[model samples]
Target: MTDLERFKNILNEHREELEKEYSISNMGLFGSYVRDDQEKGSDLDILVEFSQPISLLRFVSLKRRLSQLLDVEVDLVMKKALKPRVGERILAEVVYI
Candidate 1:
């Protein structure tokens, strides 16, 4: 399989674990992997929103879970919801799951 195909397959294999570990209610694949061809060793870019706040410890824990499942480097950029939008961490970048 191609890189993108393998990447997607890896994601499919870990969906349940992702949701359970991260408490991610809204998870999606957006950006290069979804639109453009992924080069070898390219990152799996995803966007995820948890129902509750995600602490640093939780982030690290989730990353470990993904790593075991994929056996490939996984980068998780978790975004916690903050109200008013005055000062919120930009969620523009993609996060791999």
Candidate 2:
């Protein structure tokens, strides 16, 4: 499968797990993975919107779990905490799942 396809599958898998364990309202694939410009070392960039505020421990745990599952680094951005520029860029290219 293509890298993008693999990335999506991993994302979906993690999304399911996160949804079951947390209160995720929305999630999307962003950055190079979504833009089709990822290199071999590119990490997965994800934007997540939670139904309620999540603790830092939960965020770190989620990132670690996804990184382990996908066999790559994960960069997760909380929708409520994103900077204006980063949010705009991610929103422009993100593919919500």
Candidate 3:
């Protein structure tokens, strides 16, 4: 199967685990995978929306869970809102909700 397909399966398999651990409102795959060019060395960019701000400890735990499941370099970020801001620039590789 293609990487995107594999990603979807992974998402499906871990949906419940993610919700239980992070109290996530929504999760989506972006970057290369969304563009359909994910490869062995390609990283996964996941955008996560949470109902409320998560503590550092909680976020770490959630990251650990995701890392274990995917066994790849997982880049997880959180945003207060799902909507992208006009002229909003994100400098860092990781953003937390």
Candidate 4:
């Protein structure tokens, strides 16, 4: 499978796990993987929107879990906490799942 397809599968798996364990409202894929510009070491950039505020510890733990599952680094962004420009950029590029 292509990298995007692989990443989408990984994202779907993670999304299921997250939904089972957390109160997330939305989830999406962005950045290099979504753009089809990822290099060998490009990390997965995921935007997660939670129904309520989540703790740093939880976020870190989630990132760790995703990284381990995908065998690549994960950059998790809280959708509600993004700056205006960054949010705009993410919105422009994100492929929701």
Best by lDDT: 4
Q: Per-residue lDDT tens digits of candidate 4, residues 1-97?
A: 9777887787686776687676778888899988888898889898888877778888888889878877889998988789998789999999887
Task: Encode model 2's per-residue lDDT on 1-97: one tens digit a residue.
Answer: 9776887787676776688776788988889878788898888898888888788898899888778877889998888887898778878988887
Candidate 1 at residue 52, lDDT?
76
lDDT of 3 by residue, 1-97 (tens): 9766776788788788678777888776666666666777887777777877788899878777776777766777665543465114432332222
Which stretches of model 4 miss by more than 4 angstroms? none
**Candidate 1 lDDT over residue span 1-97, tens digit each:** 7555676687777777777777787665544565566566766555567877778898788777666765655656544432435213234433344
By descending lDDT, how would the candidates be arranged? 4, 2, 3, 1
| Residue runs of model 2 more than 4 Å from their true location after superposition | none
Which pairs in model 1 have colliding backbones? Answer: 46-95
CA lDDT of every candidate: 0.61, 0.82, 0.68, 0.83
Give the per-residue Cα lDDT of candidate 1 at 94: 38
The weakest ten consecutive residues by lDDT in model 2 span: 8-17
lDDT score, candidate 4, position 29: 85
In TM-score terms, candidate 4 sits at 0.89
Rate residue 32 of model 2 by lDDT.
Answer: 87
Q: What alpha-carbon RMSD in Å does predicted model 3 have with respect to the real structure?
A: 5.4
Query: Lowest summed-lDDT stretch of 10 residues in model 1?
Result: 81-90
Model 2: number of clashes?
0
lDDT of 4 at 31: 97
